[model samples]
Target: MDMKTTSLPLSDQLLEAIEERIVTGAYPPGTRLDEVDLAKVFEVSRTPIREALIRLETMRIIEKVPRKGWVVTPISPQSLCEMFEFISELEALCGLFAARRATPFQIQQLLSAHEACRDVDDPDAYYRANEGFHKALYAAAGNSYLLEQLTEMQRRARPYRRLQLRAPERIKASFAEHEAIVAAVLARDEGAAAERLREHVMLQGDRFNRLLQSLEGFGRAGR
Candidate 1:
């Protein structure tokens, strides 16, 4: 029995289970994902399997094909770098605008979102709160177009960002980084805010190495 089959909603449970298989290498890149087979393996209805696969598809971790219903996407280090580079530029602009235009209420909401992360030990829970904080920044920026772009990019980066949180003390470090970003925004330092936001998305030095190590470890952990 899957240990994750409890309390969480049916769709969430299914998504978590399926994504775990992919990350753990049980469903490696190019591995076909059959709905009926998955339904039987998890002892669930096809409805939930379809729902879970659709969500994974949005993450760009899996895709549908002509004959193969779905297969894991081949992710590469270069591709990850390219995605982050684009995301960093988007985030930097949002942070810069937020620092300049955020109202008192929006700033308060941003702080609330960051507070939501404190004491959160679970990687998934932390990731959700972390995502909220980013969304709060976008909302503060008040740019509908940029918000739309970042929203999709954020979705693509979700799984990797969550996995990155699994690194030792990474969650704590992430929180502190968030604090610095918030501080810069509150100070209304546009350049500082942009730089910090860019740095957050584009991990450097030890942080980048940690993400790489985490990815390697994830592959090794797969069945």
Candidate 2:
């Protein structure tokens, strides 16, 4: 049987599952991923596996070798730092533009997104609301091209963001920051919005670095 011919959205499903595994450290940094084994384990065809791996490679989550299949990319502390610096600038700009350009309706929508996060008890739901809040802010900026670029950057940073949510305190702090940003937008305070957004993004990077260091220390102790 050609297992790849299944009616399911196998490629997408496989990609999401693998991505989750990677983010949760099931397949830690630098781990080797075996396509045939994953295919067997997932009870799917090799075709979907190949497609998923290719997508991951494009996302820089993994690297393909001529004869060695795929190798997972490590999330180094330095890389995380650099990514946060870039993200901070993007978000700060988005907030600044949003403050000046957002209509009353758009400001309301952003506020609603922040409120939604308060009712989200699960980490996944909280993350979804958190994303909605940011995307709403970007939309409020009224610059389609800039929003597109920022969205792509967020996609590339998804794994690290997911890691950051492992700490509930961090999630609460993020929501608080979102509230501050929304308040600034409502008041049309561009400087406050931009400064708060920058601090929010930079704080994530700082906390993530500390978290990574602690995880490494725990690993060493275990060894």
Candidate 3:
């Protein structure tokens, strides 16, 4: 909650960089992580890489595996589903409160963030924009505690969520959902906004299964 208040130390910088690669699927779940290689990649020493991995392990984003050393934590279907369920409800709450409490300027921020998500060609670009829109929504809720909790949940779900957009046409579908969410919020229709936001973010049935497979195949060949 207190993050980004100051310039990051070297270990923290490497921590975020490694976290980015893990969430972006550059270092997929189940892939073994070598501190030496990571040090080389970041042009730092093993000391910082070790510190970063220790932090990631504490967060359970990566773990020490027997015989394998450090590896990205495997995504369990149940755990992923549980996280999404919580996130969906939390986001729904954000929409509900934003509809009721957001200022005109906050609404304008939402509009701008939503527009940023428009017309993005690449999945990563769209993902970044999508993240911005969600952050704007979270802030618009006008509750500091809710913002903190939701942002933490979003952090934990980042890896799975990022990969979900890679499916063909998925980004398009997501954008359509966003439109409905924004429309409901702008109208100050709290119920509609909540429902739209919940439906947009839920991971279940076919979508859940496919993502589980992808997350498990999950790793590079032979990983």
Candidate 4:
């Protein structure tokens, strides 16, 4: 399968644009994003704009106003921390299970996805390919219920994760982390896979610090 598609679905393209703007501080929390304005900006009709807004609403990245328009959702630091903690543990559990249960075919899929990610330089292209990598890992866990939960948690954290990848040299760092994760899983080292996956999912040191600084700036702008 061609793992990297340069184009996203129309609504998804709009969603990514708006999401990038919000996470990067171009559209701070509580700033209004009107359908008409967005439609004009994206050169699309209101239909796709509405669809994108609805998806963002589900992700809790934006909210519908009472007859006004949509606004970016404000995220409290505590809430952001809690969400990341939840995703970290959830994905770590997946990695642990995957180490024990992933079939040879699944491992190959994981490696392929990683290769796709490595071949892409555009952040958006890499972002899409990166989803394939994680999805492969999630499927390899061999637990449908767990996968469902992790998928929802991942959806909720999507915007922040995209922002995380935008940090300087973060794409390389993330790929390196994935390499460690892949090696651990290939070795059937459950403990190592779990630890590496947790570290990969959970922001720390410079990355977490940078994210906190951005959140603080967004918070101040919203206030």
> How does each model score on TM-score?
0.92, 0.82, 0.80, 0.89
Pick the lDDT winner.
Answer: 1
The lDDT of each candidate is 0.88, 0.79, 0.85, 0.86
Error of 1 at 86 (Å): 1.2
Listing every candidate in turn, what is its Cα RMSD in Å to the true structure after a full C-alpha superposition? 2.0, 4.9, 5.3, 3.6
Which digits, one per residue and each the tens of the lDDT, describe model 4 over residues 1-223?
A: 1214535678877888888778767788779998898888878899999998999998888888897678888888778888998899999999999999999999999999989988576666677889999999998999999999988888889988877776788888889999999999999999999999999998767888888886667646645
Instruction: List ranges where model 2 is wrong by over 4 Å.
Output: 1-13, 45-51, 204-206, 214-223
Model 3, span 10-114: residue lDDT tens = 887787678767765678778899999988887788998999899888767998988889998876678889999999999999999999989999999999999
Q: How well is each residue in 124-183 modelled by candidate 1, as lDDT tens digits?
A: 878878989999999999999999999999878877787788888989988998999999
Residues 1-223, candidate 2, lDDT per residue (tens digit)?
A: 1236534477866876787777666677677899899999888888989999998897789888778779878877778778878888889999999999998889889878888889565565576678898989998999988898888778778666766676647788888888899888888899999999999887454586666765465445533
Q: Pick the candidate with the highest TM-score.
A: 1
Q: After superposition, how far is residue 197 of candidate 1 from its true place, in Å?
A: 0.8
